[model samples]
Target chain A: MTTETTDAELTIWRDGRFQADEWTRAAEDEAVADGPAILPLERFLAERDALVSRNAPLGVSVEPNEAIEELAPHLDRVALVTLNFPKYSDGRSSSSARLLRERYGYVGEIRAVGDVLIDQMPLMRRCGFDSFAVTNPVTRKQLAEGQWPDVPFYYQPTGSTQQAEVPAGTRPWARKPS
Target chain B: MYRYDEFDHGFVAARVDQFRDQVARRLTGELTEDQFKPLRLMNGVYLQLHAYMLRIAIPYGTLSSKQLRMLGHIARTYDRGYGHFTTRQNLQFNWPALKDIPAVLDDLAKVEMHALQTSGNCIRNVTTDHFAGAAADEITDPRPYAEILRQWSSIHPEFSFLPRKFKIAVTGAPKDRAAIQVHDIGLELKRGPDGGIGFAVYVGGGQGRTPMIAHKVRDYLAEEDLLAYVEAIMRVYNLHGRRDNKYKARIKILVHETGAEEITRQIEAEFVEVRKTELLRLPDSEIERITAYFAPPVLAEKPARSSAFEAAKADSAAFADFATYNVTPHKAAGYGVVTISLKPIGGIPGDATDVQMEAIADLADAYSQGEIRVSHEQNLVLPHVALDDMPALYAKLAEHGLATGNAGLVTDIIACPGLDYCALANARSIPLAQDLSNRFGSPERQKEIGELKIKISGCINACGHHHVGHIGLLGVDRRGEEVYQITLGGSGDETASVGTLVGPGFKTEEVVDAVETVVDTYLKLREGPDEPFLAAVRRLGQQPFKEALYGTA
Candidate 1:
């Protein structure tokens, strides 16, 4: 119900990079960073054996539930590909992060890097993401409004996304036998 | 008949407000067409050939006179004075402006109605037999269960975004009036050996680019497990059903590829997990609470048959023909169920003008218990009318142009809007249906050829249920000229199958005569009056009919 209307007013950042309104060839440019670099999932998969040989943690964002058992062992330290909201309706990336965490059991840092509508932060946490990179700039009041939608951490197993075990008497779908 | 309590009414009002906001956003350019499309579709608004079509859910095809009167108001104020009933026991309005939608929804909300999940890839309005509470063969009314499903599935968070739209139909009677077999999920209610009511579940049956019969997922799922079992099946489909191709996304294809056994095994595993939770148990008290809302109306003790009504039927051939064709047996011995044919001879099958709707609503209030139900066959029913009041009711209906003496006869066709309103249609179905009705307009002639189902579709989508008609007419455009392909011997009842195509296609002008030829041949070859056209065609095949039509076998 907040009255702020412009997308430029809210600013967010993820993975040590500040999201900006302007774009350049560098944004689209592919280069190997000297220290560490984030990459798309397909590119990482293309160079997986080489990266695995070199033991480098290549970062990439994935679609929802796009993981296989084979990708589990190598993704422990790699930076995972997350959403930049090409479209809010496109939920492929949310599924991607969940699959990586639960199905592959990846212990790496999960980041919400792009077009991460600040309102969805709690949902992001519930879906197993530990960190968020909010890109929309907001006033202090706007930031407060965009902080979180609801309580985080769903206690039950759902879809391809797994969850942390629930505390006693907290999880409602779970009931003791009569 | 399920009355909305305060909670239900508040929820519906909230939904209307949410949609009003969505519409505002779209109008103000805050949302684009792509973003709005899914939102609108979820609300049952579709952008059709000329204008937007709003499909209102007539849950289990049951309606009160007040609801019909509201629809009549919509027809007059918001639309072009009519509403078209679809095969799914829902009504579709062809023209409503984008801006006026919110107002229309607001008006509908006043009557405990909303168009939520009427379209879109989620669980749709759960349909059941139109004669749900009143059918003679029913073990129990299916509407209460359908209402429960409708409540459970409406805007459910986990199930809102599915790979494709889903349809479910349930039937309580042994005779399947709901056409359960051709739906995405078909449930036949049954009494188990333990004397508990349960369901036999069928999944994957659908009609579209690929027509499929549903596979049995479970034979007897207890009533308490119904919601959970349904949830399990949907979860499996949501997680594993293909999304890469629209045509292969239906549960039918998933069942075919993974095999029904594997699908059922997966669902059973999920069902076990779901049952371990507390949400699956719908208490008997809760079931009874829902059922109480649909309790039968109070009946005044009266004679089972009216000698005055019988004399009137015997006095006039028209009245007798109307009574013979339109009236059906009531569950209560003293009353009768009347089907007021919306499809008058040579008129569109399911189109009713605003005035006609008002007239029927008045009749419903005066005679029946202020209730009206829409049949899947696109006819309206006054489910419980005293036998003594039928003649007066018929007289009233006749004045409004709704007293056609053809309910299940040759002229009582199930037809689609076709090229007249649908952009996807290759030919016109309503005109063809009108032509056929005109050819066989005589009441005696229609009575002689009794209990035949003739379904016509403008295209292969089978909106008119042409695939399951005893005599099916499919409109196809051959080299840019409209021609129809005829199929025979199909049935949509407990024994359901796609009809086989017969001979070559006929031109638009010749289709009606061709249908006549087929019916005339059936009349000549049938062994007795009990054998219907479907049975006769099945027993004798299409060889003799083809010979009679084309001069050689």
Candidate 2:
């Protein structure tokens, strides 16, 4: 009934925080230390059960609303949710991550897993992502770009205002098509 | 024509230096392609199908002859002898190497020009009616306001990374020649009841996969609050716009999702909040100062008609045809705005050589008021040419291959640099365009056909704007062979609509014949010669053309 989460576990664990600068299988394996193993969307679909960890559940990341039904139920057992942004130009993953959180009610740690840029962090954060798995091995200077004076300045009454300091009482995402 | 003050010059110089450093870092491998891709695109450099393409901004389509010559110089020195004038009224050099782009930009900076925000997901170049000042029906020249917007939006700290690219167009005339309806943000300049100039803002209109006419956002936004209102709209789009779907990222999609009324309300609320501070409104004197930069040139008092021009028109049929087709009415009485058609019959639409560019610049200085407008339709405009100077101007233009005598005629078609240049194209568009122009080359025939626009885009990307042509030809590669698709009855005016596809695709060689058949069908079906193909299509749907096209197939 009680779930335990720690700050140190989520801060920076991928390849000891900054080991491999590329998307390698070995690097990804080492990165997932806590809840469950994070597999690419393609691998999970092929052999979902076999890839599961002995101690933790297996979590898969898929592109936008592709197979939400299959991935939603596994969220209860899975601990880490990593979405793959195949390319910066490709935005399908961003939508998929949002759907996983808001529509399917996924409570696990959601992360942006690939082709991440410093400027995109603000946008990624606003789209309901809590954790970011930096794949590019960005320097400290690049990471420092996370500071914007006042982001989420304009709040839409319709969608998620997770990045903004919206009041807890008012749920922006709750408003349906009126 | 907004003169770069110390602040403007300082800002642009700093931006150029930053880009130059970025380029140096990229070349030295300090920055990889992954890292430099966004940076390069933000500065309007794209690694297209073949080599790199550098898009230089022609702010509001207004430039002094000096700036125009600099573009010509860039073409001669850095690029393949010619430059392509794009629909966005910018000049793009196709062959500039990645390493040389910074130098090219530096050269442009020397002429007070840069390619900032010409591409990428940020706000792109602000475009306006080519005949902004010269149009007879204009309430107020929209270029001054457009220039102000250009300054405001250029490398703005916020709204740099929008969900998608945004395009804004302005028109001072009620005739709507700028295709304002199809732009992401369309502004129509008009004088209010108080005699103060304001803008009619249209939102969410764009011409791509999901083409929609932008709904009117405000009846009138005061001239002073223009920048603030624009900022408010940009803020709304940046925050609320769908980031997940690239296709649904444009403000048009948001306007569609939330009706125009709701979007307008949101924008108005934001504008009110932002305008409370003095951040967005330009002082009346500042607007006047900007407007003074584009003040009408000293025009001599001359007769509206010259007997010599009439004699030349009568004696030389070629000159007569040129005068009839190329000349447009000017706001000034004794002057006529001339469009030096770059779409010469059987030639590339926008490929003016270095010499041609120089000639155009010289002609602008000598005949016009020292200002030249690069029309979005890919033609050079002599804004305030005296009627008496027509013969001399015509002679000069003829010598430089600029006197095509076809402005809005079928031969003066708009065609993108298709497969020949662009990497994304499915088939060649320029060649097809040339062939069609050749087939309809005769001035007598072109004049007989009257105002007809034939736009050809190589692919569905619609860079060539084929979707909005009266007779739209889209080239697609089928089974490793070039195939041309025809669309009929598309227009980008106030009543903007994407052309509907008609019948199956045609082979590369048969395209000219297909266009001929369509034109002939229109000629036969038109109420009269006065009824243009577009108007005919609008009055009576595409059934006639569709039947004529596929009746024998």
Candidate 3:
């Protein structure tokens, strides 16, 4: 018996289907890509002045334990912030995402990477994550078909403009439609 | 009693469909078992020792006759012939197959019930006082707030993936029947100094490897800011709570390391910011809409004195004993709350057969205005049983072995589904409970023991709530053999305290006798019979009890 499976290829997705891969990842020793480069958080900090002066959209990939406070001041200069799950069970990144949006008022994109599961996407969206990096085959298809568990009613407000996408007809924190 | 509106129905139906597809993917090998574990757990399906376990939430312990009847149906059709009511006011079917859970959830949704967050790392089913709406001493019905929290926390986007499982309990009355002190968040409904609706908020309380009583973070939080305040607390825990060590990750530890005063400041700052947004502000109209569902039911007026009730008590000593122990004062005139004890001598503490469930549902419909409640004590309650109908209700309950007259007495033990069913348990709690039950089975012995709570857990995760039991029995595995540890002077009421550990552990064979010795010692040294076990323990301390147990000098 044969089965289809996802490859090591990673594609950025926003507004549902897979989008253009405009962002390139830069390692510490690697040279920056021409257009937009997502750097490790530590690398971004070390190269803060040079990276910021280049005028290309910059993103920083953050680990779970790293303090989001480090990126707080740099949020305006940064065009995108990438958070890792490492494993989906690790929830620290969700907090970081919320802090970026709710606390720091970061308007740039927040993307989820690594071990991203379909079950947790709606929640990730609410934590101010606007895009996801999809490599899981089943998740890729599920997202393409718009088949995530959609709970329209909400009892809390978040920094992201989520309800606007689905139009839940709810006031802030109002679960029941009035 | 809160009927699901169109929004509620749509949400649950969609969730059911979502889970059904998830299950299908798991079965077809499209999803790995590792991948499927959290999803299944989010839907309240546990991969237990023998078979899969499904926990169905009875929110705030309130159940309609129809909802309970559906549980019975799930028990018979999808599981074994029985279900176990848990310490968190939920029902667990121990033997449901993974393939059949979607069907079971479908049946539940038909009755406006679903096990949305009964497990996983999410905020669990919010529990409240069992006699929430009907207790005579209640200042306000807590079910409304519980229902509100239920809606707010259901698949909560930001807070579902917490550091650990979080629990919240609310109590309407100051008596604290829900054991608010041992939960992650405990809300006591109280009128503020100006007589406005508010909650005395307590945070960081939990019972696990480490038992801590929640500190009163805010003495008077306005009702409108309930969700905002809780959101602030959740955010703090979510961000700062230790995820490196799973064992020390609960909010209790955070409160311990950071100190209560410091944590309270952080929470207040977050609360101030969140409250300004008006995101989760509880409008009076929404509160009123939810509160209306829990309003006391209208009933035909009758005299306070029921001649038939009096006659039955006089005629049958069994009925008299039941009336004395199992019945409590209800808020409404001529009404009483009836506790149908699932704890019978030598039987499991909270197992109810499908037939018993169906019969209790019938009784609720006929006598309780179709209302039923599941207490955290593992007993079923008929919240609005009239005095005129008490005897009749008692008679029907007796037919199904449901009429045990030991609501809070020695025989009404609280035990976890230990080694018999749980993968985490070190010993068997149910058999030990049965042994104690048989030892103190008689009404004479139980009445003499009087208002004693004997809570047993097979392990320290404290699902059995041994930390707050009046006489707590904790089973520990000593070099691979089960030995029990004894703790004294614990209470779960308004004045909650963790039990102090006494000297030494007892062998499994001797543990029952050890408990008996403790009880006998209480009986011997009490100031008077009027002084209950807890009061005497508090006054005398564990010195006398310890000396009696180990014959220590």
Candidate 4:
């Protein structure tokens, strides 16, 4: 796993294009700082009271199999939730992202980190992932140029607000395509 | 058949463009074979034994005359002048250069067809009863719901990367002609007590190495909750289905390990949350709109029986045999459903030549309201043919060598493209099927035997569906040579059950003899000539056949 220094300044793709990343992910056993920080769910739970006492924004990092119910009560305080994809084929994180957005109603920036590929970007975006931490240089460059393959229309309604462009009065639940 | 809307057209067109780009990237070495494999599979391209096999979805077995002609065109222009229709109601072109795939897809798109999700760890082609709209016993047509599911599961973001491939089948008739019992999810449309449409949902049924029948998850699910409930099932499977072992990754294993009641509880719990979301809930108007597209064609009611059809049958014995065995009663008056057997004597079961395809297409336009349906049993159905047109259609079909009057008899065998074409096969299946067809080639003898399903699988993958045949033959390799194991009493219809092993095994040459012995045993044990082989096997357990095969097992 490649690691970047906190001071190197990172960027993430959110909504449609690249933007400067806001929260910094704290290394293991690192103390909470004055700026926004993202910590693993285990570490946050271990030092919750102490982190809650601080005034800075806080977030939690979740693994593919981690339960979102554990993070539900703290959703109000957390502004970002990062889900890790250890491998591209292990798709547990996609379901976790949807659970956070649709089931738990967590209104926060859900970021996809690790092993994110250009082909999966469209799917991840549809599954309630608003931001992506692309580590692959080629995918990062592609994201920067907005050159990833995408279909403007979708068959299923997803976490995204975009509606399908079917005829009016055909389906009440259909979202009109923008 | 349901026509594609502008949205569906755009979706498939964009997918074609995306796949073209991916193919280019793979050729340029920007993507490795490992990376390109899944992408190509999602578009229904497979790396077969000899070459890339492209499987195109027929969308619940419904095809228009124009679409059938397009497939004929693909078979002639791009492939080896032939196409194989699969059990999933799809067509496979076994020989096509990878460079020409994009062009083939362009042709398919012109006819409102695609190969999307035909092969992959995703929701595959949604199959249904081939006699969907025209079956006399059907309560309601299931194609509309199948179409709805097709749209909902297409490129599903969350479920696309599942642990294993998923298959769903729907049937509106009480008879399980679609083999609903052997699918991951099987929906049986039923009318509620209050006269509203609902579904009897079955989950976790599949046929492979570990063959198991499905368990009913819901006795009745409202039609409006179809998408939400299906998504709920998918979500549960996506999260809890085992990713550790590829062999045990199907939802069947998960249902087996977790218990059906427990899985149902989880699905209901998930449904509580899923149903609340407007994104997943299916609206009534949408179902209505889809249902309108499949509305039965208007047919003028004629006399119940046709004089011309009877006269033709009386004049010719071959026509009489064809009419008796190959034709099914249609719901519309004076109309009959004709099943043109792809399994001619001593021929590949589902393979059709380009000329045969074009002939079938022309016959569909002339006799069946410009519609054709592919049966899961590897036959083609003209669902609304007028009885008066039967003689002409039969004559045309005979010219193409497709007018085999053995639809449900001994010669109507279903065999997968085994070692001859498939890389995963252990032994050749088509040869055994051909040998048996020759052994029982006589139409008189086939009629005497009556409605025997002999399904052969090349390997344990059960692609040939041997597990559900009345006399099933499973080809296995024994000490570097081909051997076949026989099973009896399997059926893939409303009373679906896996067959039981009759005895040990047989050499390739003796396998056909072994099958004959079993058929001869059934012939002796059957109460009357009217009793079918499956019924006889059911009446008397495997004991009689086992004794006949192994001398005292």
In the order shown, the candidates' DockQ scores are 0.11, 0.04, 0.49, 0.56
| Per-candidate clashes, comma-separated | 17, 1, 0, 1
List, residue by residue over A1-178, the lDDT tens digit for candidate 3.
Answer: 9644333443777887676667888977988988889999998888898876686888899998788889898887889899999878778788888888877888899999998978788789888898998877888778877876666666556645533433243333544322
Output the TM-score of candidate 1. 0.83
- lDDT winner between candidates 2 and 4: 4
Cα lDDT of model 3 by residue, B1-553, tens digit: 7988777888898889889998998999988998899889999988878988999999999999998888888889988799999999999999998888899999999999998899988899999999998999999999999998988888877788889999999998999999998889999999999989999999999888899999999999999999999999998898889888889999999999999999999999989988887767888988898899888899778777788888989999889999999989988778889999999889999999999999999999999999999999999999888898988889889899999898999999999999999999998899999999999999888988899999999999989989999989998999999999998878888999999898899999999999999999999999888999999999999898889898867
For model 2, the stretches where C-alpha displacement exceeds 4 angstroms are A1-136, A141-178
Residue-level lDDT of model 1, residues B1-553, one tens digit each, is 7887655676677667767877997899976786678668878999888999999988889888999999999999999999988788888999999899999998888888889889877789888888888777888988888988887776554555566888999999989988898888999999998999999999988866577778888899999888879888887786677777877887888888999899999999978866766455677877888888899889788777788779889888888887787887878877888898877888999988889888999999999999999988999989988888888988889889988889888898999989999989999999999989989988778888988999999998888888888999999989999999998987778888778888899999888888888988898999999998888998999799889877873
Q: What TM-score would every model get versus the actual structure? A: 0.83, 0.79, 0.95, 0.95
| lDDT tens readout by residue for model 4, B1-553 | 6888777788889999999998998889988888899789989999999999999999999999999999999999999999999888999999999989999999999999999999888999999999999999999999999988988788888999899999999999999899998999999999988899999999998988888899999999999999999999999999889998888999999999999999999999999888877666667777888899999999878888899999999999999999999999999889999999999999999999988899899999888899999998899999999999999999999999999999989999999999999999989999999999999998888989999999999999999999999988898999999889998888888899999988788999899888899989988989999888998988999898888888872
User: Model 1, which residues run further than 4 Å from truth?
Assistant: A1-178, B549-553
lDDT of 2 by residue, A1-178 (tens): 9655543233332322333212223234445444445565655565556545557555566554355556766667666567766656545555555556555667766777666665565556555666666645453335544432222222222133344344221211111112
What TM-score does model 3 score on chain A?
0.84
Candidate 3 reaches a DockQ of 0.49
Model 4 misplaced regions, further than 4 Å: A1-11, A15-35, A161-169, A172-177
Better of 1 and 3 by DockQ: 3
Local distance difference test scores for all models: 0.77, 0.77, 0.88, 0.88
**Winning candidate number (DockQ):** 4
lDDT of 4 by residue, A125-160 (tens): 778887888777778776777786767667776655
Displacement of the residue A42 alpha carbon in candidate 4, Å: 3.8
